[model samples]
Structure formats: C-alpha cells, structure tokens
Target: MGSEVHECHLVCGPPAAGKTRYARVLADRLGACLLDSDQVTERLVRAGLLLAGRDPDDRDSVAYKEAYREPVYETLFELAREHLPRGPVIIVGPFTREGGEPDGLAGLEGKVGQNVIAHFVWCDPDERKRRIEMRGETRDLPKLADWDGYLTSCREDRPCWPHRFVDTT
Candidate 1:
C-alpha cells in the first residue's frame, strides 16, 4: 500500500468575501491547516513595531502603518514553501487583480511544483456587504471603493490562474 500525495489549496478572493470562513470549513473537513492573511497581518500589527494608524505617505518611518505587509507576505511564502513537505495547506487571502498583472498563483505553482490548487471564492456585492456587516460591528462599506468595478475586473480581465470559482453567497 502506498500513501497518497497531498496537494496545496490556495483560497483567494476579495476582502470580506468569506474566504476565511470557507477555508475554515474546508480545513475542518479535510484536516488541513488554514493560513489566513488578515489574521497574519493582525498578528504582525500586534507586535508593536507597526503602529495602529500612521501616514501611509511617510517615506522614512520604520514604524509606519502598512509597513508589515512586505514582511508578512514574505513570511507567508516562506511558510507555504515549508509546509509543502507536510502535505496540503490552505491559504486564505485577497489575491486581487491589479492593472492586468499576473496573480501570484504561477509563482506559487512553480515553487511547489505542480501540486497546487487555486480556488477563487466569489460572492455577490449585496451579500458581501451583508456579510461584512454581520461579521464586524465597525464595518464601513464606504471604505470599500468601487466594489462593482473591482468585481467586474476580477471576473473579466484577471489572468487565468488554473482556479476554481466557488460562490458561497
């Protein structure tokens, strides 16, 4: 008898699109680890190096807000690579399309060598708004600018990343 090989699953979608919830459910069902980006960022923010709110335009500030993203993403990729040997892991994050640029799925696939499954979770705008509201008391829909345009671009012009779209709305 031979052991079955496990494959990594990348769960990507826009913010408040239920990627984390779906990833949690999937992880519970499949016995896989869930790596959530928001949680990761929150953890980094809690380290006290990056302050809660600071000017985004500050060029020379070491403790400026959003400075943790680079290190966090680098840590994410490193963790993904490290977990490859331990079977599949689920990564839940915003893999948005920007200016027709290619998403990170290709680079991840190249690193993991053909055993990655990228899943994009799609949801209706109204449903997304509702979920975002219910999920948080401080939810501010106005901060999410151009939701319709972003969704349209994600559905239409985004590069093909060998993904499966699951609508959990």
Candidate 2:
C-alpha cells in the first residue's frame, strides 16, 4: 500500500516566532521531514561563512546571502519537490518579513509546480523580544529607533500568504 502524500508547508514569521518548534511538531504530525533555516545558516557560519545576519548593508553580503540563503531555500524546495512524489516536507524559517519576498517564493512554487502552502506565525513584539532573550540572542534584540522602525517595516511589508498567527506569549 502506498502512503498518503501531503503538500509542502512553508512555515515563516518574524524572529523568535517558534517556526522551528512548530514545524517539527507539524512534520511529526503529518509524517513529513522538517527543514530548518537556522540549522542551515549555523552550518554555514560554522564553516567560516557569514550569512545575512553579519553585515546587511555590505555589498559582499550578497555573496554570503546567495551562497547560504539561496541554497537553503533552493535545496528545501528541491527536497520538497523530490518528496512530493512520495510525501510531504515542512520548511521552517523566518523567511523574514523583510528578506523573503513573494516573487522568490513564487518562483520556488513555480519550480515545484503547485502543492505548496505558506504559513506565518505572528507574535506580539514584547513576546518576540522575550523569546529572543530566552534563546540568548541579544545582539538583534529590536533596539534603537532605527532598528525598531526597520523591524516594523519588515513586519508591515510581509507578503500576505496563507498564514496562521500563533501566540507564543
């Protein structure tokens, strides 16, 4: 007997929104594989490569961004496509409201040819800060007037995908 197949679900949201945890649990529930962006980025970082978090405005940042971020997303979609013939896959990451654009995700979907679902996890700003602090990530702790504004812009500019807002606070 053949196992049931499911569509790939892209789990996205702001920083510290529990995308990883939720993706793991969802994958388990659906008998799918979970692809985490942080793990991918950390692996690159460990290999002496800096991803987007290093220097956002630097021109050379493009190299790291393409090398790390692009592959992660591409491989994830490729894996999802490969599994589409068999089952489902769950992609967990910020897909940051600022960085992840509809065109890119659409391109991925076009490659896969349908069978994709995007979900966003939304959390209150204070709760997000607490979660970040809990995880010991202090450097990017939404501080300074400009930083706060940027975050707000990112959140507001986030594309409207089929999403589910989860309150972790």
Candidate 3:
C-alpha cells in the first residue's frame, strides 16, 4: 500500500480477556473512534446465522469461522477506513486467526492503511474464566461448557507482529 500511515489501533485477545474494556480506555485517552466488532456486528451476524439455519449463538463453530469471520472483519475495516482521516481508530476483536498468521499486521495495514498500533490484551486464565462466567452471554456458554478444550485451542504466544501486550489480570 502507500507509505502514508493512518493511526489505527488493533485491540485483540482471547474472549473475556477485557479487550473491550481496554479498548474503551485507550480510545478515550486517544480521543479515537472505537469500532468494536461485537458492538457493530454481533446482532446482525447472529441474525444472519439464524436466517441461514445455523445457531445464532454458535461463535465457535467452523461454519461461523468460514462464512462470517472474514465479512465481519471486512465490515470493521470498512468503518475504520471511513473514520481514519478524522482521527485515530481503535478496532476491538479477538483476532485469533489473524494473530496466528505471520503477515497478520501486514494484511491489516493493507486494508485500513498503516501505522497500526497493535495491542494484545490478556489476563490470567482463572480471571478470564471468571469474566466469561460473569458476562453470561449466550455465545459464551459453549466456551464455559468446554473450558479446557477452549484453552487448548487458544494461542498462548504473542501475535506474530509488532505489538504491545496488555495484561488485564
């Protein structure tokens, strides 16, 4: 892409890692535009899934990952692009797939411009589980039901890109 760098902040971590809370504080401090995936797309995605004969609350299903994930991210990037020129843009999400990819930040820069400040927000496993349980969202039921399996699936290492680590624990 162009050498021109826009201020884009990516706040990522596993579910219940306090990403949203952290993003809110960061956005407030930076006077940035916050575009949270769950806030922007969760309801619509849930509806879309239901219409497609899928469980609306099925956040961990392969079907959701394959079909809805990319589009959901695309929508966020589109919004970020629209707001970037005005000021900093903070995007909050559990970027599990992107974090694992070697060119994750590169791919994001291509989409939402450059100078991306990536933040990986996380917490102790016990605290994460506690938050998940306290939240009590339908989408979190599956995760709570299979906590060990979820932990196994999570990537313990930091993202394969330049980023700041935020421990909410």
Candidate 4:
C-alpha cells in the first residue's frame, strides 16, 4: 500500500469507531495525504449551527445533516483531488451514505478521478457506547443521552460494498 500512488482512500465508520486514528496510522504508513472531515469543517459548521439558532455541537440534528454534511464531504473530496497528484490521499468521515453500496463507492471514485479504496470501521456496540461516553465530547451529549435510539441508527454490519473491515474493538 505504501508504494501505491494516485489513489484515494475513504476511511469511514460510525462516530467513535476510531476512523480518524486508523486513517492517521494508515496515512503515515502509506505516505499519503490525510484529510479529516471534522478537522476541515468543524469550526465553520459550529458557527453555522450557532447562526441558525441551533446548538453549536449539534452534529446529529437534521438541520446539520441537511445543511452541512454534503458540503463538508464535497470539500473533503475536492481537497483529495488536489492532493492526489502528489500521492495517495486518505479521507476520514462517517460516510454512512457513501459506504452503503457499490454505486456510492463508484461515485466517490469518479469525484477524485482515481481508484478509491474504502475501509469501514466498526466495533462491538457496548464497546462503542463506552468509548463515546468516555470521550465526553459535548457534541456526543445527545447521543449519550439517547443511547438506545443512537444504537438503533448505528450500523455494526459490514457495508454492502467491497471494502476492508477495521474492528477497533
């Protein structure tokens, strides 16, 4: 993988599934450019939420999903395209929609104009919940408060698309 160049890697999973940590190590090993959606979009997204009279840490709201998620992903892919010519690029995000099927993964390849490799990270549900609570990020307050509802929404199953499974548990 280290020798591979001009390719894009999508590292995805539910929150607290260790996507960013895995991507960082993988990027170092592959000598790839690393892009994290949170790092790229958090400040602006928080500001937007505040301006919209929503909680700045409200990442799970429909308002955030509808208004901010798409643009954040687009920016990540756009940045990936810019960095790809230099070497490999690794993008880390939840990517719930994009990791669900073959077409979605193909669409991502088209965006970067390069072969795209997808990695879906997961863990035992209990472990995930524990990690979420332990991290204590304000953004996770809603999820922690509604553990059962949040668990119902999280996908522990491997994606329908061809990809690697990273078990952080």
Tens digit of per-residue lDDT, candidate 3, span 27-67: 99999999999999998999999999998889888899999
lDDT of each: 0.62, 0.63, 0.89, 0.87
Q: Estimate candidate 3's RMSD in Å.
A: 2.5
Candidate 2 residues lying further than 4 Å off, grouped into runs, are 1-5, 50-67, 97-105, 137-153, 156-158
What lDDT tens digits, residue by residue, belong to model 1 across residues 1-169? 2354666888877666678888999888888877786676654544444364543223223453246645655666667767656767787766553213465676766654556788788777778767766766332343244555545534332236567888877
Per-model TM values vs. the true structure: 0.71, 0.71, 0.94, 0.93
Q: Which stretches of model 3 miss by more than 4 angstroms?
A: 1-6
**Backbone clash tally for model 1?**
0
lDDT of 2 by residue, 25-111 (tens): 889899887777666455555344434345432212346556666666667667666777677788776666323554756765676
- Candidate number achieving the greatest TM-score relative to the actual structure: 3
Between which residue pairs do clashes occur in model 4? none
Q: Which stretches of candidate 4 lie over 4 Å from their true place?
A: 1-5
TM-score of 3: 0.94
How big is the positional error of residue 68 in model 2, measured in Å on the Cα after superposition?
2.9
Cα lDDT for residue 147, candidate 3 = 94
Local error of candidate 3 at residue 78 (angstroms): 0.6
Q: Which residue pairs in model 2 clash with each other?
A: none
Model 3 gets an lDDT of 0.89
Clashes of 2: 0
